[model samples]
Target chain A: MGGFFKSSIGRKVAMALSAFFLMFFLIIHLTVNMTSVFSADLFNELSHFMGTNPLVQFALQPVLLFGVVFHFVLGFILEWKNKKARKVTYFKNNGAANSTWMSRNMMYSGLVILAFLVIHFADFWVHEINVKYINVEPADPTRYYHELVEKFVPIWRVVAYSVAFILLGLHLGHGFTSAFQSMGSTAGRKRALQNLGKAYAVIIPLGFIIIALYHHFNHH
Target chain B: MKLKLKIWRQKNASAKGQMVDYDVSDISEHMSFLEMMDVLNEQLISKGEDPIAFDHDCREGICGMCSMYINGEAHGPDRGITTCQLHMRMFKDGDTITIEPFRAAAFPVIKDLVVDRSAFDRIQQAGGYISVNTSGNTQDANTIPISKHAADEAMDAATCIGCGACVATCKNSSAMLFVGAKVSQYALLPQGQIEAVDRVKNMVAQMDLEGFGNCTNTGACEIECPKGISLDTIARMNRELMKAHI
Candidate 1:
């Protein structure tokens, strides 16, 4: 273990494993979210079910939170170590011209995503738990679902969601391909991974964007 | 072809350095990169100015002493060839080339393009050798029939000239490639297996101790390597380290 930690391969493995864990969470989270686009009632019912579900609330919730925290912490640690290793700085350079813009700016995009998450949770998660919205009634639980859709229907809320989804897409585009490479996939598989990465980069963001637009236009 | 060269000049290790520009005309296209520098130096001496200080011995690209960051790339624009072997044809007439020493905290510039790469020597001294001595015929070379693949890999890793191009090209100035080459050279050979575990541990420790950065597998080292040392060596070193750790 000591040798592994000291070696470059060992560190890459650690990075890959953490990334895999986070990617798994992304898939599950996106699936749960897809329901909101199809039917607000179904989405609210699922959200309420998730909130009340003992298996998820007591077990999976803690695991998910731990995964997110671990992934974010490890990513930053690796970035910090990489920064310390760099010795010289270039002036007016184009070295990163070959790489994706998102790959180069992953840390910044992650920060944006984190900011969006805080706001998202405060609007939806806080209301779900605390019944804090003006129209939400604690005694009448079904009304909470109506209030949730009403909150998302606002033009500003839709715009925020669109911007957050765009950032998330950029993050996933680089994260997915990087995770695959870290796991020892090379050459032929790398091309396939990059293609899949591009697809997810478009589909995932578009999925969320469509959901936001649908809620904003049709319901309003 | 005449070219204007803005080269960094320093009197000593502690002296402040400045970019001193020189003009050298009628240069032959066939001259090696170092030869071009030699022409510039000859001109400076004739003019009564102190010649530029640089390091080069064996000019055959085997000694790893000739190191320079030419126009941002280590050892210049050509790939897989050292500064000594690089010809002047790669540059055109009237080009202003910028030459600087390999910049790294561990590799302080001594004078001009020369740097004290002895840190590499120290890391090697840390644990790069086997304890077995060859005073008397302890064992015949034929006694250990190594596999062809391992022997080839060992030879490839041994091809590393210990040139600091990997360090110069690396954004973090990580010496992972250099250390990885040293580790791989021995790790792949049967004679090196006896001390493989201790070898990697000590070398890696010394590498960090020398204030070198960690490797990020940016592939820049491989691109800028004068000898075309593969990144696979790094992977192999990583594998050996993993086995040792486990």
Candidate 2:
């Protein structure tokens, strides 16, 4: 396992494995967030249970945090090494002639996503921690839906969250297929996986955006 | 046909290089790309200036010595052929051509257009061959049989010409495609089963030590490879490495 972390493909495998973990988190996250539209009581109950569960707080949350940091830090390292590998730039480059716009600009999209993560943590994860652990606010299950609705009601926050989700979709579009390839998938299965990845890229982010818009318009 | 040429000129590996422009006229359209370059060098030599340097041998395209980045594409704009196989007809009269050496940290330029690809040689030396028994007690050759499918796959992989184009064309300077091809050629053969474990391990270690970057699966190397080396070999090599470790 130490040997796996030291090599290049090993680092790639790390990135893929971590990215898949994050992908799994996204599905469950979107599911939980969507329940607010149908019933605020159910959403708050689920959110409170998730927030207060000892297993989640002690085990899963730390793992999720580690996954995010590992994915981004490793991504930056790979980008840095890639840049150094070519000390000199080409007089001309036709990268678009060979790859798609999303495939070529993963770094830029990733940076955008990273920035969005800071805003997200600031508004949600950090706030949740402060309310639950720091200030020792009394448990209020109803606070969950109220806070979510309040955040999206602001037009600027709505636009910011919406844009971030769209960029996340674009990132996943290339990243999904690429992660599978890195892990040794080949041939027709590779193409099928790529198509499925594209669907995942569009649908998941769109789901997040829809949840935000749904709350924004129906916050009464 | 007349054409303007912008070729890279450098004194040595340490000296800074720049693109130098020149004019070559009345050239036959049927001339090979390297032959046209020869005409340019002849013009330079006649004018008492140093001629440009590039690598080419067995100009018929099998030697893998001709490495040129023409108009930003490895081995020129054509597909599945080395620069030596590209003809002057690909360019229109009065077109300006830009020629530079293959670029990568692992492949440093030796002169004007020649790059030292000895890093590839080193990586191959690490573990590209299999050991054989010649103690006069070897197994009978007639008794050993290789499946046709495996032989065909091995033949496909054995076609890699050791050109640095895959490395040069990769945005990350990744040599995975090249290493993958070499590893698969032997891994699929029955004679190669003896040292199969160490061959991949040692080769990957050497490739990493050479300062090359990781494979991001951009698919550029596959499309740009003159030999049509597939990305499948890279996955195979990864599987080979993992299986060895296990």
Candidate 3:
């Protein structure tokens, strides 16, 4: 297992598996975010449960953080090796002819997503942790509802979040089907996988953008 | 037919290569691309100029020796054929064809158009074979019954010529297609099951150690492959490697 992790395809599989974890988490995260538009009480109730639940906080949150760090670190490692793989580049490479722009620019898009993560975690996760641990504030059920409304009040934060989600869409445009392909899951139904990837690439990020926009306007 | 050629010229592995111009005339359409190069070489020799150097073994394209990045494509404009199998008919009169060796960090140019693809050989040496005993009474080859699908897939993988076309055309210069083909060939066969664990583990380790790029599912390798090796082999290899770890 250790040897496998050190191998090229092994590391790639690690990236894919980690990305899949994040992908699943995104769906859950988006669903949670979506509830804010409907009813604050319902959203706050769910957010309090997610926040206070020991299993969610201790186990699932660590796994999620590990996935993010592992995925990002492996991506950089792969990029480094990939760069070294071809010391001399082609004089006139027509890369667009061979692959989708999203597929080709994964590292760049991923870097953008990484930058987005800093802002995202800082706005929500860091605040939550600081309030809970350092500030030693008492548990508040409706805290998430107000936090969502408060965070998007800033035009800059809303736009930045919207742009990050767009970039996330670009990243997932290639990532969704690619994760399937990486794990050797898309054997025969390649076309279907590609279509599904496109849908996910579009719909999920659109959801994030809509969530941000909804909060932006609703709060303003 | 008259054709203008732009060929990369480099004396050795450490030498910098640049495109040099030459012309060949009175070329027959049926002559293979290598033969036209021979004609050009003959002309160069008569003039006491150095002839270009390239690699080739069987002109029939099975030897996996011929490699050229022609006018942008790995094996010229034609699909499903190596440089050796490409006929001059693909070219028209007054056409200018640019030819260069396969470029990758692992495949340094040995001279003119010949590159040292020993990195592939080292990768193969890592774990490309089955350890079934052949000297004495080994397990009867006919005793095992493999599914038709498995057999066909194995044969498909076994067809990889390893001409480095995948590495040459890929934006990352990835060798996953080549390594995948090799891995899939054995992974599908019953004879290969015994060593599957170590085979995938070691082979992949060697491939990474060779400084080859990662596969991003670009599909360039499948499209440009002379053998028409499917990208499925890469997926299968990934599956095999992942399973071995578990």
> Which candidate achieves the best TM-score against the true structure?
2
The most accurate candidate by DockQ is 2
Greater lDDT among 2 and 3 belongs to 2
Clashes by residue pair, model 2: none
Lowest-sum lDDT 10-residue window in model 1 chain B: B211-220
Question: For candidate 3, what is the TM-score?
Answer: 0.87
Query: Each model's number of backbone clashes?
Result: 5, 0, 0
What DockQ values do the models have?
A: 0.34, 0.69, 0.55
Measured with C-alpha atoms, the lDDT of residue B5 in candidate 1 is: 86
Q: For model 1 chain A, where is the 10-residue window of minimal lDDT? A: A90-99
lDDT of 3 by residue, B129-188 (tens): 988778887988888999999999899899998899999988788899999999999999
Model 2 Cα lDDT, one tens digit per residue, A47-142: 999999999888999999999999999999999998888887788666765567787778888999999999889989999989988998888878
lDDT of 2 by residue, B135-224 (tens): 999887567799998888889888999988899888899999999999999988888888998998899999999999988888888988
Q: Tell me which of candidates 2 and 3 scores higher on TM-score.
A: 2
- Which segments of candidate 1 are over 4 A away from where they belong? A1-13, A39-42, A58-63, A66-94, A97-106, A118-129, A132-220, B133-135
